[model samples]
Target: MNERNHISIREAIRGRITDGEWAPGAMMPGETDLAEEYGCSRTTVNRALQKLAEDGLIERKRRAGTRVREIPSRQAKFRIPILRHEIEAAGGAYSSRVAFRETLKAPGFIQSRLRLATGARVLRLHTVHLSDGQPYAFEDRWVNIKAAPGVVDAPFDIISANEWLVREVPYSSGDVRFSAMAAGQIEAQALATSLGAPLFTVERTTWLRDLYITTTKLCYRPGYHMRTEL
Candidate 1:
């Protein structure tokens, strides 16, 4: 009936799978049957099932139908953290500053990363996140203007690009990488640390279906630790 109803159907179906009411390898009911049972349209049921498949909770095959996964993928799921929330959760005040913002042609590396055409225009932003008035992380980000045109007009000075993108953009798929890197001169200045100091770094790229959204590298100050749960 509405978007909320569709979301409820999705959660209901997910509960059945996670609660083992629909055992692993169990065939899901047909979309028509599910729609009738839920008193909704078949399109709504299909949307719910599609989301489950994308989450790896089930497998869907053409003509064969859908079934709960025997072994749900062990994919490491990570939520993109908002620096403000992270700082607040740790009992510190959070703040941010936009160091630089520009619109320019994609560099060679950026073109390769986002799979963009040569000379494609993009929005580049550099920002520093602070916790309790101290440097927390430095962010270097590139946005695909073709994918998110509004980014060019966003006021990064008022709201960090990290926060803005997370709030406004919805990505269908993404990847993340974690590593350690020695701070470069710019990063050193932003984080108030010496160059060559080891820093925890995270790189992320997100896409809305086939459209690349944005890619960012966040370098945390020395002694920063990251934790995630399975």
Candidate 2:
């Protein structure tokens, strides 16, 4: 999918953060300055910086202005790896709760994106991610049963599909993308935040050889930040 205007602004801001135009803990340009620089409105700059604040990539305050956060950025690289283990490595207590689960027909968009054949079935999972006791993320995922057959009847009460796949399934390659978006009502509720909250959106397409494995859309909390070092 093509990026929206806010996402384009997000990329530009992320680029500046990555390029050292704004150092850690350094204050950033005001909304008016940024708007003038980007040839957009203050609302657009607000939307972009709001997204960065939500992602925990930057800290914003009234009067004090926005500043590059002192946090490290070693968490944004995609290397076809495991999600559950990644969570564990971050030193946060990782847990998952199933919000919705079903075996359903893949939608036309999903079918085309996953390159599934007609009549193919997909196992769908709607999950909430928890770090310690706080809500962290909401996951909407679809797995190709033809690729991971056991998911058809898999029990998610004890383990998550991500954790299970990392332990049992081996994938060859994957593609991933990230963006910024306003959270819908339901997503905001599940994430324990307010409506229209800014969120970090991550989408991934994974394949095992030529077989499509799974695709997932992950919506992170208003304070979730991802960073990576070169």
Candidate 3:
């Protein structure tokens, strides 16, 4: 069978749970019934059901049967790279400029976002993310040293903050809020564009286990967009 069969069966089970077709604590139809309905096989239904249970969307018992759980929609996220890595992958030159790094004493925004105790120190990194010889993104980030002290020593010459952090640091919390904002004179200058331009902004905050790690503001140039399917 094609790969889509697995996805079809998986989505079918989830659709029942979401539509309340399978009520919480109520047992689902047996594998035989599902196989007959989808015209697949008992094995296909079993594989799909096993994956659903592993994802915490259902519970299965030896004799009691499979039942829906009380969990909400399970979401899986990914860390998308800032720049196209084809250049780096094809042995072409990839470079980044770290314009500056400084310590900020808990600005009002980060103070509340990071849920700090006040007067906490954060590292501000201003960087121009680049690929080959072109600008990719403008990153203004604040890192909480309490969670990642080594981040201060981590290098950013050949890779981006997004790439390096995902490999080295393990964060527990991630919140992303997106908006369209007008670019100011400074943004236009760094991105090599005109003033008062439209930019897509992504505000991301992450917590490393229990300690706060970093908050970043990413600005994408004109004609930039991101898409995902539900």
Candidate 4:
């Protein structure tokens, strides 16, 4: 019904588990029953359970139903960094430009990565983030139009797609990778670095439930460092 309703149901269920009313390994009531008990819609109950699952408080199985985890899972959560905020936090002015934008049939590699149909069309963008007017990172991104149709008309020039997606899209699951790679021609040019120079890189793919949303690779300027807290 509303945000508060969803949160209340989640907390109610969480309290049951925490207070030993629903012991560890106990099967949780189905969404239909929970909805009736809470006097809310089944969709609201589902959302609450989904959040609990994400938080590692419960486990959900296709046909086995939901249950409180015997031993709650411990997961390392990483927040997607906003490039502009990152630069500003470091006491540098932030700016960005979209170097390229196009919509075309996904390439073979892109199709495989996103698990798209052979002829699926995607909106592709190349952007360079600048700090103090110097190149800081180069981003190459592909958005699945079917999953995020709003991106078709979004203005990447005004606000980078990275920030836009983070605000507008809510992902259920995602994968991220960090590595070092020699700069390619496009990445080198965009980052204003020498070709073949070693660069810090990040690749991420996001999905909303079963639907693929976007995938992107960010190549950072040389000497860049990344830190995260567990």
What TM-score should be assigned to candidate 4?
0.66
> Candidate order by TM-score, highest to lowest?
3, 1, 4, 2
Ranking by lDDT: 4, 1, 2, 3
Comparing 2 and 3 on TM-score, the stronger one:
3
Off by over 4 Å in 2: 1-83
**TM-score, model 2 to reference:** 0.63
**What residue pairs are clashing in model 3?**
none
Worst 10 residues of 4 by lDDT: 73-82
> lDDT of each model, Cα atoms only?
0.89, 0.82, 0.77, 0.90
Q: Which stretches of candidate 4 lie over 4 Å from their true place?
A: 1-78
Query: What TM-score does prediction 3 earn?
Result: 0.68
Instruction: Give one digit per residue, the lDDT tens place, for model 4 in 90-202.
Output: 99999999999899999999998889999999999999999999999999999999888899899887888988888778544789999999999998899888999999999
What local lDDT score does residue 26 receive in model 4, on the 0 to 100 scale? Answer: 91
TM-score of each: 0.67, 0.63, 0.68, 0.66
Top of the candidates by lDDT: 4
- Could you give candidate 1's per-residue lDDT for residues 1-230 as a string of tens digits? 47888899999999988998999999999899999999999889988888888778999999999999999865556666688888899999988888898999999999989989988999999999999999999999999999888899998777777778877774547888999999999999999999999999999998877778899999999999987754
- Residue 132 miss distance in model 4 (angstroms): 1.4
Which pairs of residues have clashing backbones in candidate 4? none
Candidate 2 per-residue lDDT, tens place, 17-118, comes to 989999998999899998899888888788888778867789888889998999953334445335556677877788888898888888998899889998
Q: CA lDDT of 198 in candidate 2?
A: 91
The Cα RMSD in angstroms, rounded to one decimal, for candidate 3 relative to the true structure is 6.2
Instruction: Pull out the clashing pairs in model 2.
Output: 55-224, 73-227, 73-228, 74-227, 75-227
